[model samples]
Target: MNKSEILNTIHELLKNIAPEMDPTLLGQEENIREALNIDSYDALQFIVALCEKLKIDIPEQDYGKTATIKSLLTYLEKKII
Candidate 1:
């Protein structure tokens, strides 16, 4: 999918995982931890959720690339395309 579609998917995924999260902020380029208050377990869950949904494999060492929503979407887009 494209960037916007990837972004929207990220937003939707986050909302599913955290119902109270704000959709607008989820789309920001800033750090997702700061933006969403997601801790370590949540981070792992986020990665797993994305991988499961997109049927993509995310290397353990590459977790840093998904630290932010924008970055995660970018990563997913690259993998998908």
Candidate 2:
């Protein structure tokens, strides 16, 4: 999928995880955990949800590389490509 599509999917996943979160308030480069107040458990849930929904396997070692929306986008883009 394209970057826009990937971003949209991520937004949807985030919304499912944090209904109170305002998508517009999410900074592309900001750390999602800090920005959304997501704890480690919630972050793990998000990653699992993303993997299930997108059919992608995000290695545990690479989780830190996707700390922000921009980084996640780049990671997914590379995987998709």
Q: Using lDDT, give the best candidate's number.
A: 2
lDDT tens readout by residue for model 2, 1-81: 778999998989888878898755788899998888888998999999999888989999999977998899999989886
Clashing pairs in 2: none
Q: Which candidate leads the pack in TM-score?
A: 2
Error of 2 at 39 (Å): 0.9
Q: Model 2: which ten-residue window has the lowest total lDDT?
A: 16-25
State the C-alpha lDDT per candidate: 0.78, 0.88
77: Cα error in model 2, Å:
0.5
Residue-level error in angstroms, candidate 1, position 61: 0.7
Instruction: Report the Cα lDDT for candidate 2.
Output: 0.88
lDDT (tens digit, per residue) of candidate 1 on 1-81? 778777777787777767787866654568886677777888788889888877899999999898766677667888998
lDDT, model 2, position 75 = 93
Quote the lDDT for 58 in model 1.
97
In model 1, what is the error at residue 64, expressed in angstroms? 0.5
RMSD of each: 1.6, 1.0
